[model samples]
Target: MTRLLEILISLAIVAVLFTVVGFILPSSRHLEHSVETNRKMPIVFDTLNSVRRFKDWNPSVAGDPNIKLNLSGPESGVGAKISWDSEEKALGQGSWTISKSEPGKLIAYAIEDVDRGHDKSSEFTFTPTGKGGRNIQITQAYDVNYGMNLLGRYSGLYVTSNIGEKMKLGLASLSNMLATIPNLDYTVLGKDDPALAPKLADRAGENLLVLNAAVPLNQITIQTQMKTNIEWIKKNIAANGLEAVGPVRIITNEYGSSIYSFDVAQQVRKAGTDATVKLEGLKLANNVELLYNEPGKTAVVAFKGHMSNLQNVRDALRAWAMTRGYETIDRPYEAWKNGIDPGFAPGQEGEYDVVWAIK
Candidate 1:
């Protein structure tokens, strides 16, 4: 009886010590992780916001397939919810509901990990590279709320490393998934403020098949001019039996008297040294010319939409360069990207990278 009484007293003392220790432990934790990806901002934002695709990139869900999820509400955006029930200890039972959303900028969620029936919150921010406009900085932050209990505080202490690893894996999965999609679109991913963007870099030299045209800017719009140039190049590329490799590049040879000189060109796969012009439609017969673009320092900004929206992009780039003590030289140009589709139509948006030569 004395021995039994002594053992019971010892266990009670140890429990008391644990309760005291809880007072010194932190009551909450915050974990943040970030990754850089070449995937466009809209695609990344849309993918991350969809609860139905959670298992594809979410670490906790991916770890345990036995977890059954009940995704209810709208397909995406605010009000979407994904609740899970799992026998596996790792997954447990939980739910996530979208609390806030900003299409291409941010998405915030309220997380309820019901394994212990508590609530937390998470946020994701998609910012431009500050260097490369073609890429984005994807960041996720977790604000963990630990209950005011001895056991809760103890568990929070061990969560940091495990959560970080999962975040890294989840980001990798997201990058891979976006890369596999056939045709992805790009919208402006950075802040409208250009002062925070990166410095202009050097552009490389390239040989191109160009169709130069000087048109009265007042008589026609930028869209009409670019479309006419693009159609001509497409026909010429087809006639030559060659494939265009990259964006359709345009160089403004001169800008005066409301007249703009445009050299619309494409870098194509060749048979040997060069390609001979053979296009015979739209009054462009025997008008094909080849030009080798000299490499120079340039700044790039992504424009998402029609060519008419190009002035805004040019203005932004000029502002960014002026703040950095740079001057525009020669003229600006654009390289059409395979943004949504390789083709265009009325009101259809696409990604076009505007390049400006600077000194």
Candidate 2:
């Protein structure tokens, strides 16, 4: 009887100790820290715009060089996501998406943290701290149930020590990226224009092309094999008086040529019914052809080069055309200048062109 009483008393003492320890440990939800740093507003905003560029500054990226990551969307500026997988538990699985953006002000993100036995949504704010300067604040907060509260507390300690150091490094790297982007006096092009309205034509030219059953318009569409962002092309086309005519369609000719046929009919209805015209391939060699015809009084200048280096040639052609009183009427074409299988490296010689019409 005496031994049994002593055992009961020991059990009560152990229970009391457990309760005290539980009371002392704080809840996981309360264990978070915020990190902030200041940078140029423009630079900060641009760096946070895209998660793909984070590889250049992310602390985890440096630790795991072999980690494989997949990125999606426009690569930058809102709705973009970056995800990665790793054998290292510390860097296992996670993804971040740009949740919000305000040009020069701020960009916030939502983070899905997996592999840490938790989920988190974090926000990074880019606030204008001074004239042309920005203050960036990043807060990582999460919810943890009672069972995992201890783990969360431990994470807080490491975050202030290691994670804090890495995050600061990332911010510094972003600062450098911003420094490289030159600030021009000009504003972003076409900020006031209607989203889809074509600019008014300043110069009048008949330049009409018609398609019939015998000879269809050789609508050609060639995309850069390296996944080109055709934004510049879109802006150029809109900036000029060139208007679209119809539903965009990709057609393959019997000759194994691919053509992107835009409904010029739709464009004609708006610009003028009689403005449609056509041209024939006056010259063809190695799959590169020259389509020339007098659609109107306007002059058309066209050339071809590699897809990767097409921008350079196009720029040069634009300068040449402008000097000679010409403007672009179409989003230029790649005429297969190098042939079906050209032996050249990427950014090497390929079938591309810069075509323009002169007044």
Candidate 3:
């Protein structure tokens, strides 16, 4: 009994000395992990911007099902924040808010403890890599100050192994997420105009339930007509007790200053004859008709603000396609992944992905 007691005392003293020594260690630590992805910077930026998808790839949320999580503000970019609380000690409780956003370049976040205020800093930087900016170098980093707490300071020893491993895992998940995305690149025309960047992507055909609208080959009211078609599609889909599966797509073959033709449609799950949303003055093209986006090469660009400004982007895309060997197989289309809000003033920003099918 006496020998056991001595051994226990010695062990306790050793722990005390270890913690005491930890006090002299640096209280601040910075770690970074990087991964190369074949996806373009915009897709990587978009993926990281969407915090709603974090539960799928984030290491912290990977295993925990009981965490109390509250997501507030915008789902992506500035003002986005996610607070999570857990009974697990390693998980603890805290909130992270995007503090700064420089689109396509960097995104920074500040972490705050639920009870103690400011906690740490984390960020992701996207650097263009590979040929013609077709690839991206994704760097995720964290800067943490352990303070004077011995246990906290001692935790610094594991930052490289623990936090770094998590970053690596997260990056791997991100790479996998982007792997199947069509190979795309960009030729930035101006820093002030991301929409005019002349981007390109490789896309595969998808099953769609679209509402087709045929209009005059040359009409200045195309934007207005586009919205009209969207409203019809939405109302009819809701009328059918169904929901659109994805973004609204515009289909067309002819477009010029003097001539234009188009089809405005919404993507939907493919189903049999009975499953259809019939819109007034429009046909629910129940067939998987013009869904093929050639086996490779498509033109894409950022479209925002007034849909009218999209004309400039389309012109730029045509110029880009002409410069390359690509030929336009269809009319320009906008994928409205996020709902369209046509009320924004000029120069104000929004998210709308435009694709032009080419063979």
Candidate 4:
């Protein structure tokens, strides 16, 4: 009877200890991790603002290749969401929705997990660091409320090994991804105006009369060559029973210090049918060829500047495309908004739609 009584007292004491410790534990948990990168603010912010590229840099995705993911809501900023289902017990099922976005500053997400319950959030804040603020320091923070749940408070003890470790891996992955993108500042092309930012667009396939030429890097020389090419194209268009359908396009093949090599192209179509004529039967002039530009995606930007500046704008467009994880597939080109004659006039400032084919 004495032995039985001692055993009962020891059991009661152990239960009391567990309860006391559970009550003493905090009901809330916060985890933070940071990483630094030389990438620009916009590049880092854009990556986190949209769930479109979530699978690319997310460590969790890499850990579970079989995880299925779905994207919903807007493509970027607040309301963008990504949901995932994984066979792995650790991942289970969950969704992350962008709850707040401050361009170049911060992005916050509301996280939901079947096993973790609710009232969980994560955020990424950006701060300019290093010389001339060229480098960026990114801090990721996670917060969870356990309320009165003792089990959850105890689970918080492992949060560092679980959630904290993931954040560090994720930020490292993000830095590596950013390294692949071009570091050029695209805003220089638009003079810092968001309205003039480079944008992705679709280009329909079209039949073009193309004339390739190499000319001395002089405005007058370039203009003369283009004019000669356009006249030849006009004659061919008339003979082929086709009409010029769009402004002249200049595809830059090479822009050397002393020489410029380019293709002068014009879209053409049958007058009433709006369809291009077959190239096989068409009569061609010297140095001119019929081409069918295949339909594809492109990065485009509007620029009002001299022809000499077009090359710089093309570079900027390419940088912008790279930052968005796009690959360039063809040479850059420009559609002259103003007629070729006036666009090449001395001291003339012309408007053009600079385009770079990308995939």
Candidate 5:
């Protein structure tokens, strides 16, 4: 009787010890799953990188149809930021910052949740494969101090799977959506070296006519023309809910009814504000050109202020072209800063686009 009782008591103590050890010992709860989806890498990466676009793929956006999102920095490139306040634990108060981005290739970001632990980072890679398709691979990693490591692991896995699955689906859907839109080849002007323009002209047996579209020309009474263009631009700006900059000068090559010059920049300023458009860190100076160099096509449209948003302008233009059934044949031209300081008056950036028949 004594031995039996001792044995039972010893077993009970051993069981308790084992139970305690199991609870205290560090363990990880992790889960990860992936699905292959079809989507262009650029579109996927761009959508993920921009908070404005993230809504299309975020599965955690629930119960807060009106969550306020504050945007800072550029719209889509590196150094973009989005701060959001959400009630959902999966997307509690946090901001997504672009840590690194390689256009159409890879993007990595860090998620800082004010309510959740410290920080978590995720990386997404886009790989092009055979059969005219692209595969997006997403990997999420979590790191935390010992005790919370378990929770971190589980959260990371769940969030990653959930978000990754949505991303895949969104990307797939986006691909389908984009496919429905006709694949139009954007007009990118072949690089005609400023240095080679003379040579090309010589070979073509033509005058060495350099088209300068930057500054306003000394000739031409363009007050009415400028007003007309500015008014047109203002309407477009309002339509897109973007601010307007100018009815600024436009470039036109003309001397008494015979077009000799192609500088449209001066044409815009004649009737509009004198201050030039401002852009910081724009490496490439450009000469703006019209899509169809035809007669009576002079017009101006205000591209919203974010210089980084030139793509939006391009995308908008592409859509416009599609609607008009016009084919773009030349690379879009731009004027390097018209020697204007953007700081003088913010939101005054505008462009004057003009075209003339080549006789």
Candidate 6:
């Protein structure tokens, strides 16, 4: 009887120790990882704000090649969500929804994982660093609430080795992906009006009268050359019984500091016919050529400025396309919206739809 009493006493002591240790453990977990890059704030913020490019930079996707992803809600900012299903036991099924977004500042996501059940959240905070804020530091933080779940509190002990490590890997992958995008800031293109933002568009195939010109980069010289080319295009349109159907397009070949070489083109159609009908017989000048541009996808942005600033706009447009994983397939061109009448004089404003063909 004495031995039996001793065994019961030992069991009571063990239960007490287990309960005390469980209650003593913290009921919450917080983990953070940070990475710094020279990439601008806009680029980093935009990347985190949207889930469209999530697979590209997400380290978890690389672990499971057959993982299926479904995206819902708006395209970006708050309300965007991405859910994943994987055959791998570690991944199982989970969903991430954007809970909050502050432009150039912070992005927070509500994370749900079926395998790991706990109220979890993750956020990315941006801070400008380096001299003159040329570089940005991105901090990815994670939080989980265990509450009264002792089992969850025990799991929290390994959170650093598991969730913490994933955050580190993710941040590194994000920095690498940011490096692939062009560094030029495209947001400036739409500073005054949102409509001027770079957008995906389609260009219809059309017959064009193209005149190639190479002249000194002087504003007066370039204007004179454009005038001569436009006159030739007009005469060809008249001689061939065709009508000018659209604004003039200038396809930039090269814009060197000393010389500017470009192709001056005008879309044309047979007289009294829509642009859909192909011109069968057209007279072309010796210096001009007839070329057909095929219909394709393009990134377009509107600009009202002098011609000298067009290069920067083009670069910005290309950068925007690159951020979306689009590849430039053809040389960029400009559709002069107000016609080519405005001479290339200083302070002369010209309206144009800058275009870059992409796929």
Worst 10 residues of 5 by lDDT: 198-207
Candidate 6 lDDT tens digits, 235-350: 99888888888789899999998999999999899888778665666768758888887888999999998888899889889878766657787789999988665636565789
Query: How does each model score on TM-score?
Result: 0.50, 0.43, 0.51, 0.83, 0.42, 0.82
User: Relative to the true structure, how large is the alpha-carbon lDDT of every model?
Assistant: 0.69, 0.44, 0.66, 0.84, 0.42, 0.86
TM-score, candidate number 2 = 0.43
How does model 1 fare in lDDT? 0.69
For residues 1-359, write the lDDT of model 1, one tens digit per residue: 99999999999998888888987788877888888887656567877777766766677676665678898888778988889888877788888888999988899989877432156788999988866588888999887767686677887776677666777888888777666532234223255645424346776665567777887874345446666777777787777666776778767676666877778778765544332333223222447665555678887776666655565566556544433335676667777786323324566776777777887
Please say which candidate is ahead in lDDT: 1 or 3: 1
- TM-score computed on alpha carbons, candidate 4: 0.83
* Model 2, C-alpha of 74: deviation from truth (Å): 4.9
Model number with the top lDDT = 6
**N/CA/C clash count, model 1:** 0
Ranking according to lDDT, highest score first: 6, 4, 1, 3, 2, 5
Clashing pairs in 3: 217-260, 252-331
- For each candidate, how many residue pairs have backbone atoms clashing (under 3 Å)? 0, 25, 2, 0, 20, 0
Q: What's the lDDT for residue 186 in model 4?
A: 77
Q: Candidate 1: lDDT of 56?
A: 65
TM-score: model 3 vs. ground truth:
0.51
* Cα lDDT tens digits for candidate 5, 237-276: 3443334232233333332333223333322111233323
> What range of 10 consecutive residues in model 6 has the weakest lDDT sum?
339-348
Best by TM-score: 4
lDDT of 2 at 132: 48
